[model samples]
Target: MTVQPGRRLLLIGSGWGAESLSRQLREQTNPWQVTACSGRQANPTSGADLLLWLLQEAIEPNALDHELGLWRQQWPQTPLLLVLPAQHRYKRQWLLERSVEGLLDQPAADAIAEALEVLAAGGRVIELQPETTSQHQRRGQGLGHRLLCSGVDQIERELEQINAVLQLAPIHPLQRFVLEGRRRELRMAREVLHLLWGQEPIPQAQASAPAEPLQIVLANRKGLTVLHTVEERLAHAVASLDEAQPSPLLALEALLPDRRRQLFEALLLEFRLLVERLQADPTVASSLWSGQQPLLRERALQQLVGAYTQLPKEGALVHLGDALVSSSDLQQEDPELADLLPSLLALIEGRPLLIDGGLQAPDEPAALLHLQRLVSNWLIRNGELISRELLNNCSGWPELRRAVLLPDLLATRQLDQLRNRINSAERWHTLVERPLAIYESRRLLFDIQAGRVEPTMVCDLRDAELRQLSWWQQAFTLLLEARDALAPQVELLINRVGGLMVLLLTRVVGRAIGLVGRGVMQGLGQGLQNAPSSGDQRS
Candidate 1:
């Protein structure tokens, strides 16, 4: 049956009520068309917006399951309204599993019409009549209620445990924060449930989370490149040293083959030249080195290895020359050749020119070294404080603190892996302009450390929030101390100062002070008269 030219409604079942449902559906003012089919012949057809399954009588089990499964498979998007007997009310869970939209307790013509309209408008209706319960029914309802409360309480406990860990977590997790909020909401729900049932207060929350905070640091590109190139070489050298046993020269010789030596030497020459360029731009050089010269030297050495891996030949010098000196006149003059010749000559005989030029320094990668210092300091200061907050017995998670700082080192190690991920200039700018400036700042710093961009480029991306936050923390701490120190004496100090000023303003004090002041003024005038004038001295 067609009612209107808009949404289509499919009615399936063998029932006299199916005819009633169909007629009622036709009364909808919204455009709708209806199709009536028997439960035995219930098959999905095109463009059905809603399905009404009216079962006036129970069907055979195997056939009913098969037909429902078939409808589900075919018209999964269509909302289904089940109209069945009171006995079938137990089938509520079964119908829900099948994605039934509405369950009408009694198949009334008016109710079916309203349900269809509600389903059409994307609302669900489950209208079940309240009935007087026997002792068994009451027991069953109480069991369900207890089960629900148990599940909710368990979830709250779990969330509480997670929040305990998060309290000590070095990195702030949005997911954990959201879970904490949900736990509070669940607690409120349980309180409401208690109030509604007029029961005793809910049992105390017994969930206890262990003090095991997890931490992970994000790696940057330059640090990764350094790790891959220089760190690998150091690992090889160390391994070779261990194997060669008492023959350090043999290990050194084994590790530094002639081809690798040449590459190293060429790289040293480029580094020396690069240093000259950086020195000329002192501002850029100072920030890049960050006054940690040993770390800077290590970075340069790592970049040297990267340069060799990429270029691998002496001809790469041509590219380096072009990068440094673009003018034809300067190129013709071959100033690079003149400048690098001394470093090249020194390196030819295995006297690493870096020693002379101050580029080669034996040290840990700067990023990791810097991180170690930061972590160590944090442990000494905030570690105990956080430990107190996290657990009464335990001190702190020293391992987790190190892990938190590992991102700087990890980013350096993973530079090559993330080069393509955060390499766009436009992407960098977009991140800078984002409202979460502090997070974006860290992300961009990771990119720089990863070697996705020039270390020099790091100077351009500036967000003062993290720095400001640090300053604010210090200032706030000092302000709190000052307020506390002055808090008790503040009123007394003000009153005493006010009382002294008031006494000075009184008539008796003024008269006594005036007499003394007049005598002093008269003495000063007499002294001036006795003193020699400039004119008399000159004459």
Candidate 2:
């Protein structure tokens, strides 16, 4: 299919995807005669009516400027359209100075098509205009405001450079801290400038947008049934434990041997008081279950467990108890603890009783099961309250919705990992052993409970590196651009010269040689006609 003369378009580079922009353009209904080439291969002789520059790689402003200059010289009358990446930091004024007719950042097909139509009709288009009317008004208020705005812009640029370095390079932790501190200072300065200029403080944009709420699906009846059964067993165990422990002193006496009961009574009482304090508050139980309110939980747990264990202080095994109580005192006070220490530790870690090298005590298993049930019930009862607390902390409904629907948006592999951690005893034990793993699990669990969802965070290292430019780097870039900018012009000149040389060889030299050969043939013919035949001479 032949396109009209004006519809010819030369696509300079492949777009963001695997497919070339030319192919994508051809697929559209615009009937454009698309010619695709890499940046190195582009030349003036393409006879294209429009030039579309697709900049997928990170390019410095000076480099871009030089390239644009070369393109403009090559195709003086052709309209230039630039398609930049969404995160490109190129200035609008720079592009306008180069006479770019149209600009689109990470544009869709429809947007690209519209821009093309507009450019073809001698119109201009630029999508990224962040300057608002209010900002313009503020900028024009006075010289002081203008000066402050300039200072703010400089600080922002510095911050951008620092951030780019942090994202693109792996630096020492100390160096990273220094860089981050510098960024904070710059941010403070920017804020002060904004205040002085009477401009509204800019809201910090979230790194990742909140994920959309996932559609609710039918519940798995079999899974629910299993959960219900586990709940029933846990409830039964709790009731039994409650019956066994009519009072804290009596419970301690039952659990400890007679010889050591008096020696550890005071310590046991203190531990019991701490546990009772935490247990009495419904919020603590809910927080523990849902992994919310970490500060509250941490402080409360510290008094009983020496800032680590969830168990009462007195409940720690003799060897495990530290500075608060001597190991010798604990051992002398309770010899029976030697036999039950492993079981108590296992329960605290939330490990199953049936695992290899795990706890074998029937009472300890019952106690662990009862604790689990108690925490779960507390969470169930206060679920709405916790949800409300979580929602209240979010910026808006979108954030809350993202929190609630996070699990549904997780990839299959991520979902499988979560399931394994929950269902497999081995996985759970492994997770418990790793502090980082436990912290991550708690964070994820908190998000699930709060009903918040966010997209996965990512950084384009190339883009980041490209954005970080120093004075020397800019100078070096200009030198490189000078070399690159000369390449096409040199090639074009050589091509024209070569074409003329070929014409001289084919048209002028060949014709002259043909004429000489024709004259020789004519002279031979004339000589034969003038001379007598051999047969006639013999007669």
Candidate 3:
């Protein structure tokens, strides 16, 4: 079966009102798309795509088992909740009561829409029909379109907020991001995809994204190119993240405080947001791959290992480039990534970065080198430590302070085995317009050390936030002291020789001083005497 690019919701019942509902969805798309199929098709379709097998009545056990097995393959950990029509009693409380992932009944347009939201969030659900639930009438609880619409809108809005937050965040390119920073990548990706929607813009957003002419052309041609490319490479790189965990091994909601439901909501928002951004701007793909911090993110630092593997020229240049550049940072006494500085400024300016232009003789090394060095140095220093925490105060070197807190070195094992399968930079070309920009790298490294890695897994997400605040507080203190030190010195270079001239004339009594007045009178008389003598001499 061809894999659909969207949230694939396959409906498998030809008869009844489903036909009408499908048409309605296609006609007025506030929710999503509908793809319907027959309930009983031979060699049933697999579950990588969503499988909506309508069980109006009892089916052959063999067929049911087969569907179940297929579901296991598509998303094994996620549970499939069964939906049932309440009146058709089967006396199988075991089936009804058993812990399934989710539940649905009669699935009207609203129900279908809600189900899609659940599915997109990686929610556990096994949609059941009236027969399965043993119900007669087609109503468990009626849903109002107004209510469902509002609910979906709120979810979408939250997603928008998350998307903004994620995008605003400084990040490594996608490839290097996954390679060097797994948790941050997941956090960013999850937030981005969570903001996607169909009919409207992100609600309650301070800045409603400007509407653009739909990229039907771009979506069809380059979009297809981008999608296919991103998919293939992502699949190749999946192994690195497999152990690394884009998320927890368990459902986010399984943890606590309404059982991680809030976390799940946030993650859902993130996923939609990412999807929307990609749809809106596919150029971000390049940044995703090239910020090659993971060095391990791909099999080799070079994404196109196979294509350019034998072309020793590119490989040699890049390897030599990295070595010469990174070594410069390593040997410096001050931790300044001078090389990658231009890349940082360009990133701030939001301009396209041309890796090779041969435009002019170089006056400076590239700033991308600085970022790369920063990441590599972070890795090496981290590798030497045992825990995230270092055992010293060393307040002057903030990175070192952060290093002691993290488990020495990056968690390389988390990157699954799929790294070798990826062999091209073409996959990431789509996202390159926005080069990854990491801010406060030293502090982030410190946070990694300090056990404040990312989106809090436990209900205590606030703790991570506090830890971040504390780091900034320390940094601010340092800056504040530096500010005081740098202020210009003042010794009040005062000479009082002209001090009397500066006094207020109103305070004068010499225009108030009687003695000063007499001296002025005497000088005036002398001048009068000299003027007469001058006239006589001239005659």
> How do the candidates rank by TM-score, highest first?
2, 1, 3
lDDT of 2 by residue, 456-539 (tens): 211212323334444554455555667789999999999999999999998999899899999999999999999999998999
Give per-model CA RMSD.
33.4, 35.6, 28.5
Candidate 1 worst ten-residue window by lDDT: 446-455
- 126: Cα error in model 3, Å: 7.8
What lDDT tens digits, residue by residue, belong to model 3 across residues 250-329? Answer: 21111222212222223223323343544454466345323322332122212211223231233343342232223222
Best by TM-score, which number? 2
| TM-score, structure 3 vs. true | 0.21
Ranking 2 against 3 by TM-score, winner: 2
Question: Which stretches in model 3 have alpha-carbon errors above 4 Å?
Answer: 1-5, 28-31, 40-48, 59-82, 96-100, 125-539
For each candidate in the order shown, give its overall lDDT on alpha carbons. Answer: 0.44, 0.47, 0.36
Best by lDDT: 2
